[model samples]
Target chain A: MAFAVHRPESMEAVIAALDGTASVAVSGGTLAIRAINEGKSFPLAIVSLRRAGLAGIAQDDGMIEIGAATPIAELVRPDLAFLDGVIASFGAPAVRNMATLGGNLFAPQPYGDFGVALLALDASLAIAGPSGKRRLPLSKFYETGLASNEIVTGIRFAPPAPGTWRWLKATRRALNSAAVIAVAAIIETDRSGTISAVRIALGGVDSHPVRSPVAEAGLLGQVLDSASATKAGEAAATFHPCFTDTYASAWYRRRVLPVFMRRALLGTPLETMP
Target chain B: MKSSYVSFTLNGEEKELLIEPGRRLVDVLREQCGATGTKNGCGQGSCGACTVHIDGVAMLSCLLPAELVDGSEIVTIEGVVRNRVLHVLQEAFLAQAATQCGFCTAGMIMAAKALLDCDPSPSRQAVIEALSGNVCRCTGYEPIIAAVLAAAATLAKRPAAAAAA
Candidate 1:
C-alpha cells in the first residue's frame, strides 16, 4: 500500500498533519520504518520530524531538556557523561544514530532501556497537541499514551547526583542484543550513608517499564549494602510478571530478576556479572 | 498515491529522482541509482548491510524513507573510493582478509570508515563498539576488528594520505 510521508517543518504543522488521519510520527525511523519493511500494515500517513524544529538539547536551572526528535547519538556528549553507560547499553552506534529519545519512550519491552533510566530519574515530557502544549510526567504518559493529535515535543529531567545513578542491562551478547533483564535506579543517601530517597525502574519484566515502589520503600532508612540490596531485590521481584520472547524465557527472566535487581542496586560491574 | 521528487548529493554527485510513495532509500539506491553496493540484507534496521552515511552520520538506509534524503548528503560504498584508489580501511581489510563471502564488506567498511573519520586513532574496544551493528557471520569478527585497528594505525602515521582519501 502506498502511504504519504509529510515532512512538516514546525510543531504546529506536525500536529495538523496528525489531526485526523491515521498517521504515525517518524523520528529516526528505527521503529516505524522497521515495521514498514517487515510488511506490517503501514499508517495512512507518516509525519516526519526530521525537519521539525524539535531536535536539540538545552540546560536550564539544573534541568536538562532534550528535544523529542534529537538522535540518541547526540546524547553521548561529554557534558552528559552521566548517561554514558545508559546510552551505551542501547543499540550499537549506527542504530543509536537513528534512534531518538522520544521514540525510546514508546518502544516495547526489552528495547526501551533508556526509557527505564528516565523513569528512575523522574523525567517529564513536553507534549504538543492540536489543543496546545501540555506537560505530563513520563510515568503518566506511559499509562495514557499520546492522543491521536498529540506529539511529544521534548523531555525534561534534572540531573541525578553523582554516584547515585545506576543502570544495567543484561543481554545475551555484549552488544546489539536485546535485554534479558534491564534495571535502572537512583539511590540518594544521607551524610551518614543511609538511604534517603530511591527510585528503581525495571524493563524486560513487563509489557512496559515499571517502577519498583516496594523495592524503594524497603531501601529507605537502610544503608546500601549487599544485604539491603538483596532485600530490595526480593521485594521488587515478589509479584511482578515477566514475559518471554526470543531472547529469553519467562521462567529465566523471573529467576534472574531479583539477582539483576541486586546487582543494579549494588552498582556491580557488568563484566563481573553473569 | 503520487510520485515525489527527491534531490540529494550521492557520493559527491547531485542527483534527483521521482520516487514512489513509501519507497525506502536502499531500494532507490540499488535499483534507481545503480548503486548496488549498498546491499539490502534484511530490509530492516536489525542488519547493518544497508548502512550508509546521511549528512556525515552513519544510518541504516532501509529504514530511511526516500523523501527524508531530499536535501541531504549521502555516501554509500560506491563513494568510499577516491580517484580509483581504495580507502585505507579497504586496503587494511584486504591485507587482513576481513572478507570471506564478501557480502558484508561494503557495509562493514562504511561503518568502520565513519568511526575512523570521527576518531583517527580509536582503541580496539572502540572499534569493536563502532562496528558492532554490522554482523559478519563468516569471519567471526576478530579479523575485521584487526583490520580496523590496523587501518587506524596507518591513518595515524600518514595524516596526508588519510586526508587525501
Candidate 2:
C-alpha cells in the first residue's frame, strides 16, 4: 500500500524527507506509472516536483542549467526553433510533456531520449541529497541512477565551443523505445571546413552512457572524411553492449553502432561534399 | 486526506478544493471539478484523449496530480468556447471535416490552438509535430491538419478580428 504524497518547497526539506524510511520521487510521474505497470517495482510515496516550481532553462556562467522538473515537451521548444528536428525525434508531444529531463536521466531503463543529446553535450548530474547539493559528471551519475536513494535534481553542461550536433536513435515502431541503438555526435569544423574537434557518445549498447574515445580520436583533425568516418564508425564497436530487455541482441547492437556512427558523422572523408 | 487543499485556476476561475495528493488530474477534473470535457482515453500518458492545457501547454492530465496544479491555470474543452459560440479552431475543424469518432478531436484542437497562439504561421511540419501526440482512430486527420494550418493563416491575417471576437 502506498502512502500520501509529499511536495516540499526547498531542496533541504526534500532531502530531509528522503532521510525518512523511503519513498518514490516523481516529477512528471510518467516513468513511475510505467514502472508500476511493467511490474519492475512499486514506490511507496510519490514526491511530486510540480509545486516545487523547478522549471525552465537558464544559462549560468557559460553552463546550461536545466531544472529537474523541465518537461521534455518544453525542452524540445528551443528559443531559436531550428531544433524542431531534434525535438520531433522524441515520442509525440504527449510523452514529451509528461516525461521530464531529470526523470529520464535517472530512469534505470535505457530507452530515454536524452540519453544521446545529454551525453553529446557532456552534461553533468545535479544531486540534492542530505549531503547537500553536488554535481557529478553524467557518466558517474548513470552508475547510481539505478539506486533507490539517489534523486537527480538537474543537468548542467557547457556548450561545445562551436560544432554540429547529430543524434541518431533507431525506434522499431517509430514512436516506441529504440530497439537497436542511439548516438550523439558533436564536431567542430575549421574555416577550411575540416574537422577540428569531435566527440561521440553512444547509448543502448552499454550499462551506462559511454564516450567513444576511439571514434572521437579517429575523427579529430582528419577533415572527418568519409574514409576516416568509416574508421571512426568501426572504432565505436569496441564499447561493451548494453544487452537487456527485448530491444535488440548484443550482436545486433554492435553491428548497428558502426552504421549509426558513420551516418551520424556525415560530410567528412567521403569527399561527397566539400 | 481532507486537509489537502488545492487552489488553482480552472477555465479562468480561481478554485480551491480539498483533495488528496494521489488524486489524478483526470479524476479531479471529472469528479470534483465537474468538468467532464477532459476525457481519459488511457490512464497512462500514451493516449492524448486526456489532454488539457496547463499553463498554455498540452499535458496528459492522467499523468499529473490534481495537487500538482494547485496554482496553475487549466483550460479544458468546455473552456474553449465563448458564449456558446465555437472557437475559430472548432469552426476550422468543422469546415475542414476533422472529426469522425471524435475521441481525439478536443485534445487535438487544444494542442493545435496552443501551437497557433504561440506561432500563428507554423509550417506544415510544425502543425504535424504539435498534434503528433493526438491519435484519431478515424482517418480524418488529413483534413484536421489542413484545417489547423488554414485557421492559423486566417488568424494570422486577422489577429485583431480573431482576438476581438
In each prediction, how many residue pairs overlap at the backbone (N, C-alpha, C within less than 3 A)?
0, 10
Model 1 chain A poorest 10 in a row by lDDT: A232-241
On residues A134-230, what C-alpha lDDT tens digit does candidate 2 reach at each position?
Answer: 7888876665553445567788887655438777665565553443677787888888867887778877777666777888888887876667777
The TM-scores of chain A alone, one per candidate, are: 0.96, 0.86
Candidate 2 error regions (>4 Å): A33-41, A73-85, A108-110, A146-148, A171-180, A188-197, A217-223, A242-256, A267-274, B1-3, B156-158
Docking class of 1: medium
For all candidates, state DockQ relative to the true structure: 0.79, 0.39
Worst 10 residues of 1 chain B by lDDT: B39-48
- Off-target runs (Cα >4 Å) in candidate 1 are A270-274
Q: Write the per-residue lDDT of candidate 1 for residues A1-274, one digit (tens) a residue.
A: 3478899999999988887878888898898888877878468888899889899999999999999999999998976898888887788888999999998888888898878989998999999998899999999988999876888999999998889888878789988878888889999989998999999998888889888788888899999888898888777667668888999998888778778888888888857875
At residue A31, candidate 1 shows an lDDT of 85
Record all residue pairs in model 1 with backbone atoms less than 3 Å apart, i.e. clashing: none
Candidate 1 RMSD to the correct structure: 1.3
